[model samples]
Target chain A: MIGYLRDIEKSFPIKDIGKRRQRVLKGISFEIKKGEVLGLVGLNGQGKSTTIKIMLGLLRPDRGDVKIQGHKPGEIDTLRHIAYLPENPWFFDNLNAKEFLYFIANLRQIDKERLKQEVEEMIKRVGLSGNEKKVIRKYSKGMVQRLGLAQAFLGDADFIILDEPLSGLDPEGRKMAKDLIKGHKKKQKTVFFTSHILEDIEQMADRVLIMNRGRIIKEVHRADLYNKTLEQVFIETIEHDRNN
Target chain B: MIEIIKLTLKEAKREKGFYAGLILLFLSLICYFIVESFAMFEPEKVMAVYALSSVEGLSIILLFFLIFSFLSQDLNKKGIEYMLTLPIKRRDYILGRFFGINISVFILAIISTFIYMLLHLLMFGVCPFAFLIQLILLMALVLMLSSLPFLLITASKRPTLIAFLVFFIYVIGINLDDAVRFLSTRHGREIPVVSRALLKISYYIFPNFSFFDVKIPIAYKLSFSTMHIVFALLYGILYTFFILLFSIMLFQNKEIK
Candidate 1:
C-alpha cells in the first residue's frame, strides 16, 4: 500500500467557548494501493478532509497509525514522494504564478536546469501559460485553482492527494482537471482525491469510498459504478447511514 | 531549508510593510540629523544615542510586525499548508523563517548604520568605530529578539493573541532586572511572600532584554570590554537556539486544519 490509515481518530479543541472539544474523525481506516485512483466522497463536515489531512500529515490522528510507503506520515522521506492540493488552495499573494511554481519546484529539489522548463510546462499544462507573470492575489478564483493544480502536478511525485480539486472550476476547467487526473492514471501514479461532484469521481476514480459523519460507511469499486449511478449510491448510502 | 529561507526572504522583500519600515527608518534618520544639528551641547553624543536607539527600536518593531504578519498570513490563508506538504521538516520551517527574518533585519540594520555613519562623517568628520561596533552588537541582539515572536507564533494560532503576548513579553523582558530588584527589596516587603517569590521567578523565566540594550554605553562612548560583547554574542546564540528548538517542538505537533 502507498498509503494506509489504521483506526485513525482526530478531535479539535474549541477555545474560549462552552464547547470543550469537537471530534472530527472517529477510528477511520483505509488503504491506497499504488497506481490506483481512490476517490473519497462526502458532504460537508464528514471526515473526508480529515482523513486526507491525516494521510498528508497535516493533522495528526489523535489515535492509531498512519503511514505512507511504510513510513509514518509527516516523515520527510515519505513526503518526498507525495504532492497535495488543499480544498481552498491559497498561494503567496506576493509571488507570481511562475515564482510560486519555482518555489514549489525548489522544494521538490528539481534541478536548476529543469526548474524553469518544468514550471513553464506545468503552467501551460494547467492552462495558465500567459497569466504566469501576474501575482497570485490578482488571479481569479479559477486561476488560483489552476495554479494549485499546476503545483500539485509538477515534478515526479509518486502519490498525489487533492482535496476538492474541482470546486471553483468552470465547466471547461473541470474537464481539464478530469483529463489531468486521467493523465496521472496513465502514468500509473497513486492518487487520492476528495470531491462533492460524484460525476468527477465516476469519471476518474478506480474506487470510491463514501464517508458520512466521520466514518467510511461504504466502499464501491469501479465495476459497481458501472452497475449503478454514483449519485444514487452516494445518496442512498448517506441516507441509509443517517437513518441508522 | 535553504529553499524555505530563500522563499521567505523573497516574500519579505515583496511585502509593502517591509519597504515601508525601511522608508520610515530613513525618515527617522533624516529627522534625527535635523534635530541634532540644532543641539547646543555634545551634538555627536546626542546624535549617536538618538540614531542608535531609533534604529534599534524601529528594527524591533519592524521585525515584530513582520513576524506577526507572516505567521498570520500563513495561518489565516493556509500558506503554511503549502510548506508543510513539501519534503521539509517542521524544524527546518521554523529555522528558515527565523533566519530569513534575521537576515532581513540585519540588512536593515546595516543600511541604518551606513546612513548613520554618513551623517556622522558629514557632521563630525569621523566614523565613530565604537558606535559601529555597538550597532553590530545590537544586530546580534535583534536576531535573538526575532526568535521570541516565532516561538509565540508556533505556540498560538491567533495573530492578535500572539502580538499581545509578544508585546507583553517584550515589556516584561526589558524591565526584568528592575522588577526582580523591586521584588527582592524593602519596597516589595509589603507584598505576600508567595507573590514576591512568583515575581522573582517570573524574572528568570522571561528573557533579559536589558542585556541587549547598550544605548547608555554607546551614547557615552564608554570603553566597554570586548569580553562582554563576546559573552553577549554567545548568550544571544544560545538563547535563540533554545527558543527556536521550543518553537520547532510546538510547530511539529501543530495541526493545520
Candidate 2:
C-alpha cells in the first residue's frame, strides 16, 4: 500500500468563544495501493480536505492510524516520498514561478545538476513558460493553480496527494492537469486526489470513495460503475443514504 | 532548511519595511537635530541622546513588528501549510525562519549602527568605539525578543491580543529593573505583599530587557564594566535558545487548522 488511514476521527474547536467541538471526520478509513488512482468526492465541508490533512500530518486525528510508505504521517521518511497540493494552494506571493519551483525543488532534494533543467521542463509542461519570471502575485487564479500542479508533480514524488487539484483551472489548464495525471499513471505512480467534479473523478480515478458527513458512504470501482454515469450514481447514493 | 531560509530572504527582499525603517530612522535623526538646536546648553549632547534613543526605539519597534508580521502573515495566509508539508522537520523549519529573520535583523542592525555613527560624528565630532558596542547590544536585545513572536503565534490564535502582549512585555521588561528599584523604596511598603512578590517573581520570569539598555551610560559618558556586556550577551543567547526550543515543541504538536 502506498497510503493507509484506519478508523480516523478528527474534530476542531468551534470558532466562537466556547469549549464546544465540531467533529469534521468521524471514522474515515481507506487505503491506496501502489500505482492506483484514488479519488475522494464529497460536498463542501464534508471533511475531504481534513482527511487529506490528516494523512499529510498537517492536522492530527483525534483517533486512528495513518501511514504513508509504511511510516507515520509527517515523518521525514514518509514526507520525502509524498508531495501535497493543498485545496486553496496558498504560496509565497513574492517569488516568481521559477524561484518558487526552485524553492520546492530544493526542498525535494532533487540533484543539483538536474534541478535547473527539471524546473524549466516543469514550467513549460505546466504551460507557464513565457511567464516564468513573473511573480505569482501577478498570476491569475488559473495560472496559480497550474503552478500548484507544477510543484506537485516536481522531483519524481512517488505518492501525490492533491486536494481540489483542478478547482481553479480553465479548459486548457484542466487538460494540462489531466494529462499530467495520465503521465503519472503511465509511470505507475500512486495518485490520490479529492474533487467535487464527478466527471473528472470518473475519468481519472480507478476507485472513487464517496464521503459525506465525515464518513465514506460508498465506494465504486471503474469496473463496477456499469450502465450509469458517476453523477447519477453519486446523487442516487447520497439520496439513498439520506432516506435511510 | 537552507531552501526555507533562501525563500525567507527572497520574501524579505520584497518587503517594503526594510526600506521604510531606514527612511524612518533618517527622518527621526533630522527631527532630533532640529529639536536639540533649541537647547541652549550642550545642544550637541542633547542631540546625541535623542538620536541614539530614536535609533534604539525605532529599531526595537520595527524589528518586533517586522518579525511578528512575517510569521503571523504566513500563518493567516496559509503559506505555512505549504511550508510544513515539505520533507523537512518542523524544528528545521522553525530554526530556518529564526535564522533567516535574524540575518535580516543583522543587516538592519549594521546599517542603522553606521547611520548612528555618522550622525554622532556630525553632531559631536567624536564617535567613540563605545557606540558600536552599545548598538550591537541593542541588536542583541532585539534579537533575543524576536523569538517571542514565534512562541506566541504557536501558542495562541489571538493575533491582536498577542501583539498587545508583546508590546506590554517589552514595556514591562525594559522598565522592570527600574520598577523594582522604585518599588523597593519607602513608597513600596504601601503595596500588598502578594502583589510585590508577584512582581519580584515576574522580574525573574520575563527577560530582563533593562539589562541591555546602555543609553544613560552612553549619554553621560559613564563607564560600564565589560562584565556587564558579557553577562548581557550570555543572557540574550540563552533566553533565545530556550524559548525557541519551547516554541518548536509547541509547533510539533500544534494542529494547523
Candidate 3:
C-alpha cells in the first residue's frame, strides 16, 4: 500500500473558549495501492479535502491512524516519494517560474548535478519555457496552474496527490493536465486526485470514491462504471444517502 | 532548510517594504540630523543618540512587519500547504524562516550602521568605538524583539490580534524592570502590593528589553564592561532560541485547513 487511512475521525473547536465542536471527518478509511489512480468526489462541505489533508498529515486526526508508505504522514523519508499540489494552488508570488521550480527541487533533495537540467526540462514539459522569467504574480491563473503542475511532477515523485488539479485550467490546460496525470500512471506511479468533474474522474481514475457529509458513501471501480455514467451513479448514490 | 532560507531572502528582496524601509531609514536620519543641528551645546551627541535610536526603532518595526507578514501571508493564502507537503521536518521550516528573516533584519541593520558611520565621519569626525559597540548591541536587541512575532504568528491567526499581543509584550518587556523599580520607590509605595509583586515577577521572567537600551551610554560614550556586552548578546540569542522553539512546537501541531 502506498497510503492508508483507517477509522480516521477529526473535529475542530468551533469557538475560542469552549468545547463546542464541528465534526469534519468521521470514521473515514481507505487505501491506495501502488500505481493506482484514485479519484475522490464529494459535494461542497463534505470531508473530501479534510480526508486528503489527514492522509497527508496536514491536519491531525482526532482519532484513528494514517500511514504513507509504511511511515506516518509528513515523515521526511516518506515525503521524499510523495508530491502534493493543493486545491487552488498558491505559490510564492515573488519568484519566477524557474526560480520557484528550483526551490522545490532543492527541497526535494534532487541530485544537485541534475537539478538545473531537470528543472529546465520540467518547465518546458509544463509549457512554461517561454515565460520562465516572469514572476508568478504576473502570470495568469492558467499559467499558475501550469507551474503548479510543473512542481508536482518535478523530483520524480512516486506518488502524486492533486486537489482540484483541473479547476483553473482552460481546455488546452485541462488536456495537458490529464495527459500529465496519465503519464504518471504509465510510469507505474500512483496518483490520488480530487475533482468535481465526473467525466474527468471517470476517464482518469481506476476507481472513484464518493464522499458525503464526512463519510464515504460509495466506491465504484472503473470496470463497474462501464454500464452507467459516473454522474448518474453519483447522483443516485448521493440522493440515496441523503434520504437515509 | 537552506532552500527555505534562500526562498525567504529572495521574497524579502522582492517586497516593496524592503526598498521603502531603506528610503524611510535615510529620511528619518536626515530629519534627525536637521533637528539635532539646532542643538547649541552638543549637536553631534544629540544627533548620535536620536539617529541611533531612530534606526533601531525603525528597524525593529520593519522587522516585525516583515517577519510577521511572511509567515502570516503563507498561512492566510494557504501557501504553507505547498511547503508542509514537501519532504521537510516542521522544525526545519520554522528554523529556516527564522534565520532568513533574521538575516534580512541584520542586512537592514548593516545599512543603517553604514549610513550612521558615514554621517558621523563627514560631520563629527571619527565615530566613537563605544557607539559602534552600542550599535552591535542594538542589532542584538532588534533580533530579540523581532523574534516575538515568529512565536505570536504561530499562536494566533488574526493579524490584528498578533500585532496587539506583540505590542503588548514589547511594552511590558521594555518597561517591566522600570515599572518594578518605580513601584519599589518611596513615591510609588501607594501602588497595590499584588500589582507590584506581579510586575516584579514578570520583570524577572520576561526578556528584559530595557537592559539592551544603550542609547544614553552611546550618547555619553560611556565605557561598558566586556561582561555587560557579552551578557546582552547572550541574552538576545537565548531569548530568540526560546521563542523559535516555542513557535516550532505550536506549528508542528497546526492544521493547515
Candidate 3 has a TM-score of: 0.96
Off by over 4 Å in 2: A14-20
Give per-residue CA lDDT, model 3, range B1-257, as digits (tens): 78788988999898877887888897887796678668888887888787778777777777777766785677778767778888888888777777788788788877787788788778889765565776788777777776777687666767667767777888888887678779868977988888777877887777788878787877877766788888988998898888878888888888777
Maximum-DockQ candidate? 3
Docking class of 2: high
Question: Please, what are the lDDT tens digits per residue for candidate 1 over residues A1-244?
Answer: 6878888888887764576888888888889998999999999888787787788888888899888988988889999999999888888888899988988898888999999899988898889988999988899999999988988899968999999999899988898888888888789888899988898898889999999888889999989866789999999999999999
Model 2 residue A232 distance off true place after TM-score fit, in angstroms: 0.8
Task: Using DockQ as the measure, name the better of candidate 1 and candidate 3.
Answer: 3
Runs of candidate 1 with Cα error greater than 4 angstroms are A13-22, B180-196
Relative to the true structure, how large is the alpha-carbon lDDT of every model?
Answer: 0.84, 0.84, 0.84
Residues B127-189, model 2: lDDT tens digits? 755667767788778777788877997877766667778788888888899879977799887
TM-score of chain A of each: 0.95, 0.97, 0.97
User: Tens-digit lDDT track for model 2 on A1-244?
Assistant: 7978999999888965678999999898888899988999878889988888888888888899988999988889999999988887878888899999988898888999999999999999999999999988899988899999999999979999988899989888899999999899889998999988999999999999999899999999998888899999999988888898
DockQ of the candidate models in sequence: 0.78, 0.83, 0.84
Give every collision pair in model 2. Answer: none
Native contacts recovered, in order, as a fraction for each? 0.86, 0.90, 0.94
B-chain TM-score for every candidate: 0.91, 0.93, 0.92
TM-score top scorer: 3
